[model samples]
Target chain A: MLDHNAAAARIFTAALIVIGDEILSGRTHDKNIAQVATWLQVQGIRLKEVRVVADEEPAIVEAVNTLRARNDYLFTTGGIGPTHDDITVDAIAAALGVGVEVHPAARAILEDYYATRGGLTEARLRMARVPAGADLIPNRFTGAPGIRWGNIYIMAGVPSITAGMLEALTGTLEGGAPLLSETIGCWVGESEVADLLRQTEKTHEGCQIGSYPFWREGRTGANFVIRSVDPDRLAACCAALAAGLTAGGRTPVAGGL
Target chain B: MLDHNAAAARIFTAALIVIGDEILSGRTHDKNIAQVATWLQVQGIRLKEVRVVADEEPAIVEAVNTLRARNDYLFTTGGIGPTHDDITVDAIAAALGVGVEVHPAARAILEDYYATRGGLTEARLRMARVPAGADLIPNRFTGAPGIRWGNIYIMAGVPSITAGMLEALTGTLEGGAPLLSETIGCWVGESEVADLLRQTEKTHEGCQIGSYPFWREGRTGANFVIRSVDPDRLAACCAALAAGLTAGGRTPVAGGL
Candidate 1:
């Protein structure tokens, strides 16, 4: 059990960079962050950090260089389309000190997909451009395949297309045990149970407790989320928390409110 | 108009740091990024970048130090509650090379607010703690006030509470002209109009056009958003793009698809 816990501590982490002007301008609400985070969790890869940057080259390059160097994998969404504003591939190539080139597989895919809609124009061909020495992640939804350079992935800005790309890459990356979680909700203010929550977390090894308070139906309540890499540990911690809340004269909802 | 454009080019920029393990764990979807970005836009401050980091002290401290040094304002959300995981105050204090102290006004406010519900426990008093020499941003919804220290605003993690803090801060910061934008939607693939969009943007002196493509109702379409500090320039850019789209045999929707 101890060795297993120790081995599980080698967590694989990923960072996400969302590249677009619309998000920073507040014109579009970004769904990619949550989408990528949730998908990474299922793959047992912890999303360590996320950066939402503009469509500028320097910003994208800096983010790409900084995050990719530190994490196991770096994923970027947006700015891969066929517009003048789509500068992600170029910026990433610059960050890697490599030149950009049109990938043959990507070009073939786009050409065949666009044969009926419209012959691939120069603008549409931009989607085939990728960093030098890069592979392709198949985009089942969109004709333009996503770009994969070493540990970095350049995916579509559109949520549905990005989802498709992620689905294709599932189980391909090596990661540790999937982090498990259990949520317990109580109709009481968080401050009233802060001590109990802290002590419960302290008593439970390899577990973390997060308190999220809310006001709904004109009453104060909180949801305590307990997380662990071990399902048994997570369940034990959750049960302990529920027992504490019950002793404090509050009913604990097993799955949260 | 040239002088005015030059003056408007001096853009006030802000960076946001969203601190939470829940967001990173995919347990919660972040709404604060869009909320802060929209509010900053109305205040004429450009949201240059956003970093969503974990609740760990080192991550928060590093993000706070890095962003605060580069941008005009640095705002952080999350980890301000009355629990062990709520370590934002300590982290920010560490980042600023200052000590954490309970603010008198904040303590008073919490005490008064919690008087009828329950006496202010040590856990609740955690909300009163802030970086030394920081001012309070009044939270009308809850007793726990937000903190502000030298260009850094520490807001609540909850959407509604953060909204109240932003409402209190509206029109308080000095900023330049608010960026104006006009959106035109058309039932045409972005690749088909990529050249026209690029040329229209080049023709406009102080405007940028962002093309967002989507598929709806079994048809491909796009929305081109034209943004500029000068409203007239924005309007002209929108009109030129609209005319270009129309000339390409597509009807342009004024408000977007």
Candidate 2:
């Protein structure tokens, strides 16, 4: 496991390669992008880009190669299954310039899975093949473990399993302090948050303050949101926002949040 | 608007450029990617890529340039609202190498909207500024219309409205026959699908047949999905799958699909 606490200050970037035809066909809603984006952000890593490609080998290989080369980390979800459409291994193998081999670690895991689950056949063993010189990101959900090698993390496309595997692998990553955010809702519209939003940013340098206009109960209002990695600075900004809101006569409660 | 029929036969490609901090923060689940993917798929246009980016101008600018340059069509959603986080217009301007101007046609629509909504301030008018030389994609939800310039089609991130706008814009683009697909479920495990899946693909030279392993109701099975632009070819693959399943002692239903 990597020391996540020590790597806080450095920049981390990731790219998601969503490989599937169902997603492109609009039959399947990708439940991964936003989830991955947020997880990376809170971990102090930036999800720099995402690419959704069809199951085509060339497209997948090209995407994996391009993104893996450019970003600090590449987390790919989808295309790791037992079916014939499951070609992420081939694509990744191509991307890394390596041959696909049944990884011993993954093979042991699959054997255990077959012992427990029963009826898992050699076709299921296809999931055991990992590119040369790769380790596994333990799949807590099923037998098919994901691979992590050279900044590329290949996981499953299934939403529940993808999230769980990512969470399990969280400790392996070096992360900065999780970003903290606070929000204050007001009857004020964007126009009202405009001045405060600008002032808030100026007063709290290094923090991001944004005005969000929303409609609720037939009334137009705005939510002022503040985000920063610095905890003390975050609290100070909240205090200033509460004071400003109260001074502006908006009955600021505990949440200038 | 461009002629829809003219755009139908051409193989149009799209890239989704999502701009929002909420998405990156996981504060919100982005509903735009799947919607656009489905819309483009049904239109005979392929949604080739998707990128969910922060509201940062540079990120949006970079994604716009990349997606637009590579694909035949590019669709962007979010960040074109009436608040501080809404920086899509300026980014699109930067992407297109043009100045940000209040598109007269779009501004007229906004004026009419404010006349009724009663909270239309100058800040609200910010939604009216589009990249110079862009045309508007009509908004069915709110009056703030999405815009189109060059190869990019920009729309709101909100699902209902984004979908409505996409539906309205469908007739304008040229594309191939929407990729047709046939899906059949079986109780046989994914291993069973492997041989049949390969055979189906081998038989249908131009079609893509994907076998997906799914576990549900204490039974592990695979869904045979055959996709192609030609309807006859897709049907033939499905027929072969059914025949193969029946030969293997599993009575496959011809069509519950």
Among these predictions, the greatest lDDT belongs to 1
Off by over 4 Å in 2: A1-7, A115-122, A246-257, B1-9, B116-120, B251-257
**Ten contiguous residues with the weakest lDDT in model 1 chain A:** A2-11
Give the clashing residue pairs of candidate 1, or none. Answer: none
- TM-score of each model's B chain? 0.97, 0.91
Once fitted onto the true fold, the runs of candidate 1 whose alpha carbons sit more than 4 angstroms away are: A1-7, B1-9
Q: Which digits, one per residue and each the tens of the lDDT, describe model 2 over residues B128-234?
A: 89899989899876788989998889898767778878987987887776878878877776675677777778878768877666667777766677788777888
Candidate 1 local lDDT, B4-64, one digit each (tens): 7766778899999999988988888999999999999999999999999998999999899
Quality class of the docking in candidate 2, CAPRI style: medium
Per-chain TM-score of chain B, candidate 1?
0.97
Model 2 chain B: ten consecutive residues of lowest lDDT:
B1-10
Write down the C-alpha DockQ for each prediction: 0.84, 0.58
Residue B172: error of model 1 in Å? 0.2
Cα error, candidate 1, residue B240 (Å): 1.5
Write down the lDDT of every candidate, Cα atoms only. Answer: 0.93, 0.79
